[model samples]
Target: MDVQGVRAAYRRYARHYDRYFGKVFHDGRKLAIEQMAILPGEHVLEVGVGTGLSLPEYPDGVRVTGIDLSPEMIQHAQTRVEDLELPDVTLLEMDASAMEFSDASFDHVVAMYVLSVAPEPERVIAEMRRVCKPGGRLYIVNHFRNANRIISSLERALAPLSQLLGFRPDFSLDEFVAHNDLDVLEAHPVNLFGYWTLLTAAREPTCRGGASPDLERSIRSH
Candidate 1:
């Protein structure tokens, strides 16, 4: 799927997207965010921050930078930021597979229900790992092929259209995480048939240094 095309499609539905999908999506988001346990004074990067629904959960003084591929979604998100009085939050149009930042740039990275919709989910995950601080967590809440024989068969039938529509490829997440070598700290299955997994993991701390001076300097200067 063309990521830009998906972004454009979302724009046409931006006004009602949340209202229609909020219950299902936010239920997943709430579960993921709670597991993240975002704290005060942390610098967070929210990838694919459509409509900024996660904005309210972040505590004050926790700096946030959100990036999305959709400009229209960002417009509505900006209003939410303003109305919520979240002055420190920033949103920009960006692609998840190609972030413009140095390594270890963020204290935490979140992609809520984001990976499955990306054209290249593995590449996007690698990018998320690259920008995240060595010890900082990468959190993902995603829907995958259901386990039931009936539902799984249906997914197989619709696989082509779903892939073309930016749905995830049929892959085992356990194998993916293992291949990536991330230390999985938590994994919880949500909804019936265990279709969604809220996962958190970190890079091995053995290679991590203390906080980057440049990161600290940038935060202080802000």
Candidate 2:
């Protein structure tokens, strides 16, 4: 979809975005936030931070900068941030591909369910990596194509409609990470039986050392 199309769709859905998605994706959203585990004093950048659903879950004293493509969504997020009385929070309407930040600027980057809608997931991933500090982390929680044969068939059937609705049918988590040279620390199958992918990774510093032990074991087991 073009920029205008994306903007229009999101604008129309901005007010009801959270209510519609929060209910359908309630469990997945909660799971994603639990996995983030942000700590105080950390600098975090949240991409596609629609409505700031995860804002209240963030730890106090941590600096959060939220970026989104839709102005309407950002407006709603700002209001919610004010309602929570959160300090050190900044919201920017920007493209993920062209992030206006210096290299290694963030201690952590979280993009929950953001990639699937991006026109270029790889470009966004690279940008996310670029902004994250060498030893810092990138966390992603996204819904992907189901691995189960029966479920996969159902997803295939709905692919066309889903795409028009701003959802990519399926993206290979492993391939995307490896292609971008990202050091994936951990990946978990969360919600909907291997349909949702949760991942944590670091930049180049940890790449040579390899991913975390827990992550290795999980990947090996799966």
Candidate 3:
């Protein structure tokens, strides 16, 4: 889906999104934040922070900057920040694939249920790696294509309906991991029936010249 399509879909869903997905996805959000282990005064970035459902879960003293492409979704998030009196949170209407922050701007970055919906998942991952400081944590939670044959086939069949649902049903975890030079720390299932996977990785420090040529080649080859 294109940016405009994403915006339109989320705009239409913003009012009722929580009603539909809030509790269902709450566990993954909580788990991701807990795993972050955000220290006091650290800066965190959340890409595709729809409606700020996870804002209140963050502890005090840590600053959070959340970005999403949908203005309507951001409006709801803004209201959430106000209602909760979350002084350290900020929400912006911005694209995840092309962030405007300086390099290594955040101490930690997370994207829950976003990769499958982003227009360019690889570009989004690159930007996530770019803005995160070396050794910083990266967390992702999303529903990936099931490995089970029957379910995998069902997901593939429903892939075209993403234009209406706002997320692709056939996103593959193996493909995403292979295409990005990420230092994966851990990956586990979350939510009911193990429908969502929580992935944790770290941004490796850049070498003298740049990232290792071999790593770049491997990612490109994939």
**Which sequence of candidate numbers ranks them by lDDT, best first?**
3, 2, 1
CA deviation > 4 Å runs, candidate 2: 23-37, 192-194, 205-222
Q: Pick the candidate with the highest lDDT.
A: 3
Q: List the residue pairs that clash in candidate 2.
A: none
Pick the winner on TM-score between candidates 2 and 3.
3
The Cα error of candidate 3 at residue 146, in Å, is 0.7
For candidate 1, give the lDDT of residue 172: 50
The superposed Cα distance between candidate 2 and the true structure at residue 152, in angstroms, equals: 1.7
TM-score of structure candidate 1: 0.83
Cα lDDT of all candidates, in order? 0.74, 0.76, 0.87
CA lDDT of 77 in candidate 2?
95
Sorted by TM-score (best first), the order is 3, 2, 1
| Structural similarity to truth (TM-score) of each candidate | 0.83, 0.84, 0.91
Best by TM-score: 3
lDDT per residue as tens, model 3, 1-222: 989889889989999999998999999999999999999999999999999999999999999999999998899999999988999998998999999999999999999999999988889999998999987878989888886789989999999899898999998776666667666677768899767888888776223332333322232233
lDDT of 2 by residue, 5-123 (tens): 56777888899998887655555656665666767788889998988887877777889899999999899999998998888899999998789999999988888888877767778
